[model samples]
Target: MQLIKIDKTQNYIINTGTIAGDMEGTSGGPTNPGPLSIYLEEGRIAAITGTKDDPYRFKQPNRQTTFLDLGSLTILPPLADCHVHLALDGLDFATARRRWEQPGELHTQISTQLWDTVRHGILAVRDGGDRPGIALRYRELVASGELTGPVIRASGWALRKPRKYGSFLGRGVPAEMLDSALGQLARHGVDQIKVLVSGVVSFKEYSRVGPVQYTYEELSAIVQGARNLGLGVMAHASSDEAVALAVKAGVNTVEHGYFLSRDTLKLMAEKQVAWIPTVVPVAAQLTSLHPAPNQDNYVIAKTVDRQLAMINEARNLGVTLGVGTDSGASGVRHGYSYRQELALYRQAGLTPEEIIRCATINSARVLGLNWGRIAPGNPAAMIAVSGDPLGDINNLRNIEYVFQPV
Candidate 1:
C-alpha cells in the first residue's frame, strides 16, 4: 500500500490477474479474474494481453519502461460519481447551506476534496450543482494539468425558479427564462446543465419533497436549449410529477427519483433516460441517528428502504442507473461516498459486477467521458484495491493504488 511515481511518457506494464472494465462479463455475478498484462503507451492503455498471448509489445519506439507486479490485486476502471456538490464540506448539511464567503478558503477545501476523491479511485465526477467559479477553476486545473482530480463534469450551479427555492449552490431564475439560463450555464463552460425541477427531498416531513420548480414546458425549453448547445441536462427531481415532467422534457438524467413509482421507472427506461438515485445523503443521516432515530432520521431510514426497493424495480425494468453519492452533503465524505453508494447498491440487490458498472461505466456514459473502460485506447485511469471487488463490493473501500494523470 504505497504510492509510486513515473514520468509522463514512460512506458509501464501493470501485471494483475484481475482486470474489470468495458462492462465486460459483468452480469450480476463476480467476473472470473484472469492474468492480464496491461501495457501503457503515452499514458493510455496501449494493449491488454492475457497469459496465452505474447506479452503485448508496443509496435512503436518507446522509452524506459517499468513493470509493476500487482499479482492478485483487483484492478478496475477508475470510478465515476454522477452527482455531487463540490462546494459543500459534508459537515451537517443543515448548518452549511450557503457557499463559502471567502474565495481563497473555498478553493483550498475544494482542492483538497478533489484530491481526496481522485486518490480514492474516482476518475470522473459530475458535479450536480455548485457555486459559480468554484467548479470552473477545478475543471481548468484538471484540464491544464495543474492539479490531479477526477475529470470534472460540472453543472456550474443549477437553474431554479426565483423567490421560491433557496439559492445556496445555484441561482434562481424564472421558468420563462429557461432558455437564457441554459445559455448562461453553457457560457460558463458547464459540461452539462442542471435544472432544479423540484426541491430536495425533506427528511423531516414524511413523503414531502421540496416545491416543484419548473413546469414541463419550461423544462422542455431548458432541455432543448441545452441540447442545442451540445450540453446534457441533468434534472434535480424527487417528486413523481417532477420526475415525469423531466423525463417528458427529455433531460439526460434524473437526479433523485426517491418517490417515483414503478410506472415512472418504466417510462424512464423506455425513454432511455438515466436515473441517479442519490442514496448516501439520506443514508448519512441514518448512519448518524440510528438506534435513537428522530422523526427526520426515521423518515430518512424509511425513505432509504423505499429507495432500495425502487432501485431493485428499476433494475428489473432495464433502466440505466448511475451511482451518485450526493457527496458534500452531511456525513457523506468526498472520495468515500463512491463506495458508500456502491455498498448501498449491493444492498439493493445489485451484485458486485452490477454495482461496479453503475459506479464506473454507467456513470461515465452519463458524464460523456472517454473512461470507465480499461480498453487499449482509453485513458490509463484505474484503481487497485486490496481484495477482489467482484467477490465483495465493499472491498472497494480498500483502495491500494489510484492511476490518473500523474
Candidate 2:
C-alpha cells in the first residue's frame, strides 16, 4: 500500500491508507508539527499518523517513490456535473446525431467534450439522456480510458410522449409501448432512464402553459418500470404539474425543473428527491439570438423572468439542488455553461461552498457514484485550481489543472 500524509496543522489530516478505497475524515485536525510524513506501499497508503517524536513510525515495507511538496495546493474533492447532454450543443440535432453515426466521430466528439469539461474542473458526469446508444457508447469509451474525460454514467434514450416534448431529442414511444421501450434500454445497459414529462417555457412551441407530454399514469408507469429494473429515473420537467407527477412517481432527480410550484418543491424535499436545475438552457435562450421561433424576444424575456423566480423559490425551499447544464442545446456551450450554472446558483442565493457542494458531492450522489470526495481510498479523481473557491465560486471557471485515474 502507498500512503500519503497531509498534516494541516489543525484543520484535517489525510492519511492515504493501504486499502484501495480507504478514506477517513477526522475532526481533530492535523497531527503535531512535523514534516508531514508520507508512505507508499503498493500504490496505496499504508498508514498516516502525526506525532512530533516519530512521524514515520507507522511506515510499513516499501519506500516513498514520489514526493510532491504540498506547500500551496488546496486539496478538495473532485467535482461532478449531474446533468449534461453530451450530444446537444448549439449545433443542430440532425448534425450532432450525424456526427455520432460516423465511425470514430462519436468517440471524438465525446472525448473533446469530456476533456473540455475536465479542464473546467468537472471529473464526473451524469448524462441525462440523448439519442439511443449515444450515452452508452460514450460511457464505455470513458470507462475503458480510451477517452480522456469525466467519469460518465448515462441513460439510454429519454422517454417522451410520441411526437411531443423531447421527442426530437429522445425516443418517442407511444404510452402503451413504454414498458417495451424501457426494457430495450435496459438491455442496452443504460445506467439510468430519463423521462420527458413536460415542455420548456423557453421553447415557444412547447411552452409550459401548454399541455404536458405524459399523463400521470404514463409517468408512473415509466418510473415503476425503470425501478423494477433496478435503474434510477430522471425526469425532464418544466411545469408545476409535471414536477408534481415526477416527484409522486419517485423519479430520483428532476432535470430542468423550471416551473416547480411551492407544493412540488415541498414534495421533493419530503420525498428526498434530488434536483438538477439546468439553468444554462434557459439562460442561453434569454441571451442569444439564434433566429429560432422558440427564441422570440418577448417570449424569451418572459421565460427568463419566470424561470428565475421559480429557481429562487426552489432554493428558498431548500431543494437538494445539483449542478447541470443542457450543454449540447443551442447556445449552451459545453464547458462554459457549467460556469454559468454555478453563477446562476449563486444568484439563486447559494453560497460558494454550497454551490461547490451542489456541483461536486450532490451531483455525484444524484448519479449514485462514490468518487466525489477527496479522502484516502476514493478514486484519485481530482483537480487543482489557482485561487480559493471558498471566497469566489467563479474560481472554478479558471481551473488550471486536472488529475484523473490515468
Candidate 3:
C-alpha cells in the first residue's frame, strides 16, 4: 500500500473494480458496476461512466490523458479524521510536550504522523487545539506544500475557563475577556474555535465525567463571540449536563461526548450540530499496548459499551455522527487508531456502509472539505482499496492507493 499525491492538474482516466457509492455519494446505495471509468480533469472528477461486462466500451481519451487500470480494487472517497491532536504522540505525553520546544524535533515528529495518517487513506483532518499552537503552524506548512499531509482544519488553541481542565490545550480566559480571547484566536488565523466546556471522562469510575466548565450563559457568550469572528465553535464536552449546555448554546460540534443522554442527541439533531464521539481514546485504555499496572479494565469496558449505545442512538435520531479517533491521546495512535475507532462504530451497530459514510462524508463535513463524495465536479480525493469496504469495513485497511489533491 502506498500514498500517491495527485498534485499536478492533468487529465486522468482511472478504471477500477467498483465505486463504493452511487453518483450522489449516499451509502448503501447502488454502486456503479465495474470495471468503471473515472475521468479527472483539473483536479476534479469530470465524469464516471462504465459497464461491468465491457470495461472500456464508452471510453474516449485525449492525447494528454493518463490511463491506469486497477483490476480488483474498489474506489471510494478518502477517509477523514474529525478530531485529532497532532502535537501529542499518543505514546508519551511528557516527551512529546518536551519536544515541542525544539522546533526541528517537533517538525520531524509531526511530519511522520502526517505521513502515517495519509498511509491509512485519510486525506483530511480537523485538529484539536494545543497550547503551543503547533498544529496551526503545521496546517499552514501543509497548505504551502512545505509539508505533505492531510488538508487540516485547525483550532489554533482551545479556550477554557480559568482553572479548568484544558491547560495543555490553551490558555484560560475569564468570561469578561471572551471577546478579546476570540479576537486573539481569529488574528492567529484559526480555522475554528475550540472551547473546553468540560474536563474529561473518568476511567476509574464508570459514567463519571469531569465537571462542566462553563455556565450556560458563559458558553452561549463564547459561541456568539466566535460566530461574530466568522468562526465555528468545537466544544469539548463530556458529561450530559455539559453536552446539553453546549448544544443549547449553539456550539457547532461536540467532541468526546461520552455520557450524552438520548434527549441531548435529539436536541443536537434538531439544532443540526454534529457529534464526534471520540470513543477510541477511552476504549484504548482497556487495550493499550502498555497497560497500566492498576488499571480497571471492567469499568473502561462498560464505559465504552455505553458510549457505543449512544452512538447508535445518535444515528437513529438523525443526528449527524462523524468518525473521530482522538488520536495522540494516551492510548490512541495516529493513523493506526482510526481502524480501531471504525471497528468500535461497527460494535455500535452501524452497518459497514453507514460507518464508511461517517468516516468519509460525515467527517469531511465536519472538517469543511468538499472532497468526500466522488461525483462529477467534486475534488478528486479518493482511495483505492483491495477489497469491497461495503461488504466488510476491515477491507479499508488494505489501502492500495490514495488520490490526494495536493
Q: TM-score winner among the candidates?
A: 3
Task: Identify the runs in model 1 with alpha carbons over 4 angstroms from their true place.
Answer: 1-8, 26-32, 92-99, 289-295
Query: Considering every candidate listed, which one attains the maximal lDDT?
Result: 3
Give the lDDT of residue 8 in candidate 1.
Answer: 63
Tens digits of lDDT, candidate 1, 74-147: 78888888888887877655444443676776677778888888777887888878646477667888878777
Poorest 10 consecutive residues of model 2 by lDDT?
16-25
Q: Write one digit per residue (lDDT tens) for candidate 3, span 1-406.
A: 7766664446788988888845244545647657788877777787787763433322334436778888979998999999999999998888999998888898888999999999999999899999989899999999999988999889988999889898999998888888898999999999999999999877778878878887999999988888888899999999899999999999999998988899999999999999999998988888787776666899889989999999999989999989889898998889999999999999999999889889988889888887768887788899999877888999999999998877
What stretches of model 2 exceed 4 Å from their correct place? 1-64, 92-94, 203-210, 289-291
After superposing candidate 3 on the true structure, give the runs of residues whose Cα lies further than 4 Å from its correct spot: 23-30, 51-63, 292-294
What's model 1's lDDT at 16? 88
Model 3 gets an lDDT of 0.87
- TM, every model: 0.93, 0.84, 0.95
lDDT per model, in order?
A: 0.80, 0.68, 0.87
For residues 120-209, could you state the per-residue lDDT of candidate 2 as single tens digits?
777778887776557678788777767767777888788887778675468878988998999999998988998888876656633445
